[model samples]
Structure formats: C-alpha cells, structure tokens
Target: MLKFSILKCLPVLAVCALLAACVGPQKQTAGYDYTAFKSAKPRSILVLPPLNETVDVNATNGMLSQMTMPLAESGYYVLPVAEVAETFRQNGISLPVEMQATSPKKLREIFGADAVLYTKVTQYGSVYRVVDSSTVVTATAKLVSLGTGDVLWQGGASANGKELGNVDFGSGSIIGMMVQAAVKQVAHSLADKSQEVAGLTSQRLLSAGQPNGLLYGPHSPKYGSD
Candidate 1:
C-alpha cells in the first residue's frame, strides 16, 4: 500500500540517514588522555565570529550559528552574544554595527573563557564551476589555550548542498533554498565534529589531570576510544 509520494522522498531520507552514518561512528583517535579539564566545568565559553574570508560575506554567520548549536546541545553554559559584544566595546575593539566576530584576547577578557575557539574559512562558495555547483563549504576550527596560545583541539567540516540531479541549483531562488539545505547538511557534520572534538578534548584534559574548564559530551564515544 505504499504510495509513489512516499517512495519519492526515499533519496532525501536515505541521504539524511547516510549523512549521520558517515559522520557518526567516526574513526576514534588513539592514545589520548584527559584528567585536567573536567575538574572545573566549562562554566562559560564563547565562539568568536568565524573569519569570513569566503567568497560569501554571510558565510561567517553560518559557521557561528552551526558551532553554537552543538556546544549548547552538549550542556555547557554559553556566554551571551551581547555580553561578548559589550566586552569587545570595553576593550577598544570597534566592531561594526553588523559585525559579530570575536577576537581571541577579547574573548578571553569578556567571557573569562579558559579557552577560545577560532575558526577560519579555508574554502567557501565556489572556485571552479565547470564540474559542479560551487556548493561545498569548508572551515578549519581550532581551540586555543587562553593561557598559552597552544592549540588544544582542531577540527574541520565540509557541507554538500542540494542538487537537482546534475543541474546546479546555483542559478536562482533555488539558490537560497540550496544554501539553507547546505547549512543543514553541514550542521550535522559539524555536530559530529563537535562531538569528536569534545570527546578528544575531554581525553586530553583527563590525561593531563588538569581542569582545562571545558567539556564536550560523551555522546561522541569515539573521542574517548581514540
């Protein structure tokens, strides 16, 4: 009694399922230990506005928003944007009315974050269009120790946009929809990345026996095994 309409969404559903499968059960890193960071829970943390550096000016918001969801989902107390903004103001960093990116030092001073996460967009929009719709976006995120500037954790993710078969959706109104679809796709990947980062960061903190003040959830068991 299955209708064609039900069958029609099979690919979309299948892709969505596969996307999680691909990111989940991810390869766990080996020989990592943590003991230092868990002693003091990460009371408040801040994600600096990602550097756009992309062909698209709006790319920064996409990453920032995506990054927030995973961390918030994991249960850490996140610093409010307004507070971070105010901190920036007091520090003498003049952010444009529309700007929201956070600087490293400013993040430390404003949120008193034990660590700061910095992200740089390495690839965005499209560079070569002949083969596919320049719909793939990638970013490199690094967690730096506020005390030493040492990178505590690092991860990256790439999102694939909606495709109407072989035709690129990059030409019209569909572009906006495609961009949104891409963000959703990327959000899942970034969530996985966040899980992995949190897991690994936990291990690092636990191994060091130092309370680094941040904790990623155990949902990502791969972080512990690796």
Candidate 2:
C-alpha cells in the first residue's frame, strides 16, 4: 500500500517540475542599437536648453544646469552652457522652441559638437492632495549624432519627495503633522527642491556605467572596450 501511494505522487511531482521550468526567467535584449554610437566615436557633446513641458517655468534652466556634470563625467567634453545659451540668444533663438527648431546640422556647424543632448521635462514641482503633498520631477533625454541626426540612445528618470500617506504621526498629534507638512512645503518652495531632484534624474539618465546606459565615449578610458 505504501509503495503504491508513493508511485501515485510521481506524475504530480514531474508536472510541477516541468511547469517551473516553463516559467523560468526570460532573456532580456538591449533595446537600442549601438552600431552608430560605436562608429561615431563622438568626443564632444552639446546640451540643448530643455523644452519645459511642465507648468514650472524654472524647470528648463533647473534641468539644464544638472545635465553637464553627468555627461562630462561620462567622458565627453561639454560646451559651456552659458556660452551656448548666450550664443543662441545672440542668434535670435531665445526660446527653447526656436532653438529646437534649428536644424541639427546648423547646431553642429555652429558649436562643432560631435553629438547633442536634448532633454524634456515632463513633470516638476509638487502636487497637493487633500491629505498631503507629493513633489516629483520627471525628465527624458536623448543623445543624437550631430553629423547624421540619428538618436543613438535615450532614457528617462523621475524623483519623488516624501508623501504623507497613512501616517502614525508618532508622538505628535494630527495637528502637529499638518504643521510639519506645511513647514516642509514652505521650505521646498523657498529652496526649489525640484533642482535637487533634477540632478538625480539627470545622473540616472546620463551615467555611462549602468547597464543599458550610454557607451563610453572616445575620451573615456573604457572607450573601445565598452
């Protein structure tokens, strides 16, 4: 009887093992093609003034200021942002829309950059709910070959501030928590915390060492090896 019971469970065990095998981890593919990137071997990058799709007018400059460090650290020479902006202004392309409308060939001709980084800010600043506020900044960036106007790579990232969701308030009462939230709001308003968040977002988008991130440029030590 014992032997028969053990034999009866063998088919069920085999089926479970087969099902597990079928559900195993799937392989992932690198989404973007790097052939052009490798061939171009771009050494200098021009970062454009961000197109601000958010209600916050400051988002454009805030996000723009954060892009240079990450890209430069990624082993590419970045043009002085002030000089670039001023040049655009002198050329009567003051608005981001106007600047973007200018042809990539023209930009390369003027700045002599091998590639350009275009960024868009989709979200910036805080959203107030009935209970609390959540501050978030979201942005997308793309690297385009100035020579060919082909987008070699692109990515996006977001950063969020604390949210007061089902809060215990600890030793403080509801009123105290409200006051604290209000103080935080005031601090953020004065300090423009969105800029800090934008820095984080830029780093995530431009950092070269990450998986699926930009390949090392010719200036980088890992250039061809990457």
Encode model 2's per-residue lDDT on 95-135: one tens digit a residue. 98788878899999999999998889999887554335556
Pairs that collide, model 2: none
Error of 1 at 56 (Å): 1.8
Q: What is the lDDT of residue 197 in candidate 2?
A: 78
The whole-model lDDT of each prediction reads: 0.51, 0.81
Per-residue alpha-carbon lDDT of candidate 1 for residues 187-213, written as tens digits (9 for 90 to 100)? 534443332332332233222112332
Error of 2 at 94 (Å): 0.5
Per-residue lDDT for 182 in model 1? 61
lDDT score, candidate 1: 0.51
